[model samples]
Target: MTDPLLTETREDEKTAAWWRQAAVYQIYPRSFADANGDGLGDIPGIVSRVDYLAQLGIDAVWLSPFYPSALADGGYDVADYRDVDPRLGTLEDFDAMVAALHERGIRVVVDIVPNHTSDLHEWFQEALAAGRGSDARERYIFRDGEGPDGAEPPTDWGAAFGGPAWERVEDGQWYLHSFATEQPDLNWDHPEVRADFLKTLRFWSDRGVDGFRIDVAHMLTKDLTEPLPSRAELELLDRSSGRHPLADRDEVHEIYAEWRKVFNEYDPPRTAVAEAWVETPERRAKYASAEGLGQAFNFDLLVADFDADQFLRIIADNLEQARATGSSTTWVLSNHDVTRHATRYGLAPLAGRPVKQGVEWVAAGGPEDELDRARGARRANAATLLLLGLPGSTYLYQGEELGLHEVAAISAEQRQDPSFFRGASFDGLGRDGCRVPLPWTASGSSFGFGADGAHLPQPAWFAEHAVDVEAADPSSTLSLYRDALRLRHLLQAEEALVWTDTGRADVLRFARPNGWEIVTNFGEEPFDLAADAANVVLSSLALDGQLLPGEATAWIAPA
Candidate 1:
């Protein structure tokens, strides 16, 4: 029989070790749904939405840092890794939420912030009070200043967001903070620091968390030498050859190797994906290697243009590198950190590449008039379909299914990201645009986010893409995602990709091992698909009688 269209059922076959070849939906808890009237999304809000997640056919849900925090760096500044933030929920609430997801046959992957801790964390507080050269201060990367009276930072190092990476203490010492000053980098060389993270892993694993998304997986260990490497040396270090003094050092893999031991001790073997930002695919695969975390995020598609050559090369390299490490590739397009792809694809081209426009582009009141929003939407839809049809795991960020765009209209006074205030060269426009509260329904000031209000403001136009509105339209992006994900569930066992030449530079065509073929048209001209309508499986845009529309993607079954 021809491959039957799959249904969104709780199939035991699609789990795929509960990680590999899985569809994991990322829920930015603060903006996903709000249960209480406190104007913020919480665990209870997520608990209430388990049914929706199961309906979405995702194998797991990766909840971004929900631990106790000061809201610095959007919960990445974790004060307590062992417990849930009171604003979000309590320990019991967390357990209940985990249980709910498990009951629905959905796994939970928590965000683990091992690279740093909140300045308000107990360890950091102790480091502050313990004075310079004290045992408590050793818990973090602290050093004496370089210049007169210690006015200068330890070295010429700069922060990930902006400014000096080191923060001066009341004492003469300075502590390193790769990101915001509120987040102090931990001393991974410290035994207790290493042991504490092991305890953290066990704490969540014991609570039934199936996996973890390691924050800054490659930045955990640093060279931390006296008279640290100069900014030029650090910046000029060849990423292809030697270890980096600040990020992606060789010693970091030792930390992850230890982590793999703990992950292996679990029943089904808890899985983890490294959020490493290394450039080379081989280096990126190291984070996902057998000795390290089992998977690493492949972000090649995120920054690339909607061109076929770029997509094909990235897909081929990603699969090859990931396979070499005996790990599955983790693919993503947009997340809480960047601008939504629908909006990103709408921007004007720069230097023959997709302009590196992020939330900042939107924040600056970008060229909305010149943006081909329709074209962007088409490309994004096609891209997502292509991503879903690939051989490995796919991560779906919240609001993408509803075809959400980056909301630049947000007022500056209401913006909350640290990058906005820090003026960091990295994602300088701030990530608040992409992190806006999701609209579940078209009604209410908060658009069904909660009873009272949302922490971040939702624009009025958000109503057009509300879940309730899209749920009624079969042609909507929401319906397209629902159908695509369900159909993908049946292809969990297929893992090989064989490229098929379409005789066009603008067309990307590939065939899965299971006789299912996928084709994407990125050119201005539409391409005629050889498959008949009876053999068509799914498509981003409805086929015009066997002709795949421009800026669209389609799946066809074997004749």
Candidate 2:
């Protein structure tokens, strides 16, 4: 029987040693740390805290966009590929950070926004100046048609941010921007464009960065004929233009294959983890084939509502796909771009289960307060173990280990992302709630996040969630995260096989081949096992059979 994942597998399998056993920690740099006492985070800040990250038991760190840009799209819009943003720091600061991180055996992966460039980027500006009459016009797709009443978009495609996908250029011609108008999609079909991108890749690789996490990897190539539509989405195609937009483009794979070659040329093993959001498993696999990407994010698991069937299907599908093509799949639940998993599952401090054994904060009183905090820590601990138990690459967003929930109050004025301005509707407004600055103190309201007169306002009650307080308390969420990550490393050292057994869907279970069986009751109610008196290695619950609420997980070994 033919495997479903293989678009085409070659004899040579590209290997990146750092990735296999890696526990990649994704840092949205803007919120990670601010060096220079500036409210905004910079490379110097990251450098200052290199040891903090190294201690997290992570093999690598994927830093989101530090490139020079207008910040229209929160640094996704690239103004310069070779230069570090002045606001971020000088290029030397980056080199220093990389060297410091290397000393601690932590590989650094930077974000590469290849699909599009900021309107302020030299290339985009040049393309605009060249206009409809020049060849540069081919750099981006241009169409001529009267929109609604000669003013609305010609198609019904909406922007991922929340507005029309097409923007009328100064020249009076409509240009396609699946995201913000400031972020014009690049034409990968152009030979010059491809050459420029390769050069950019080379530039970064020469700078000694370990690898790149290609942003919106699937959106690089688009269907020029039928632009994306703008309206309420009924089908997947309705949401995205009927055109493939980016994935499975022959040209795209070809370009990616060349990028693979570039990475191979580096001295040490380097990688390129593609952020491809293709819905179909087949399409996702094609991007991860030996000739295409090193690994692609399996986002199907991220959006999957908590359920046994969905969780099992996700693992099985990805495992089948990756193994077929001899490629790796990236498993993750939350990122800076979406609602945090804890928040998504409605794990808010609401009135439901017993308050004492719940994740709610109450006035410091009897053992009930201690029990509440303990339960919250356990919920976070089990969830982390569950995600880490899955096979293939896993991405842990910053502060996720702290079990951070989505902050509720982010007024329109506080919103800084450009995606929000583009989309008229706030459905899936680029995850600002989860991307807010990290909490690091328990003394003041700002959580020691900023000095007085900072650019970004600190959220109210920030101090309550600071790392200092959590670090001091052994049972705090911070300690739980550190312990869980350390546990994953230990499991790997024991030669555990993180493989998938497609026997049950509703019951999310995995084993080490060695007696360890990790299982989760993704659904409500207790699940009895075939084995009698299983050795419960770890559980989200107490000895008493109280089913820990949503996403409750446990680890066991057959007696």
TM-score of each: 0.94, 0.83
lDDT minimum window of 10 residues, candidate 2 = 357-366
Q: Model 1: per-residue lDDT, tens digit, 210-253?
A: 99999888888877676678887787887755377777777788
| Cα shift from native, residue 403, model 1 (Å) | 0.1
lDDT of 2 by residue, 330-414 (tens): 7787788776665545433322322221112221111222333334444455666787765466789988766676554555577
Candidate 2 lands at a TM-score of 0.83
Local distance difference test values of all predictions, in order: 0.84, 0.67
- Once fitted onto the true fold, the runs of candidate 1 whose alpha carbons sit more than 4 angstroms away are 1-16, 350-366
| lDDT accuracy of residue 28 in candidate 1 | 98
lDDT of 1 at 387: 92
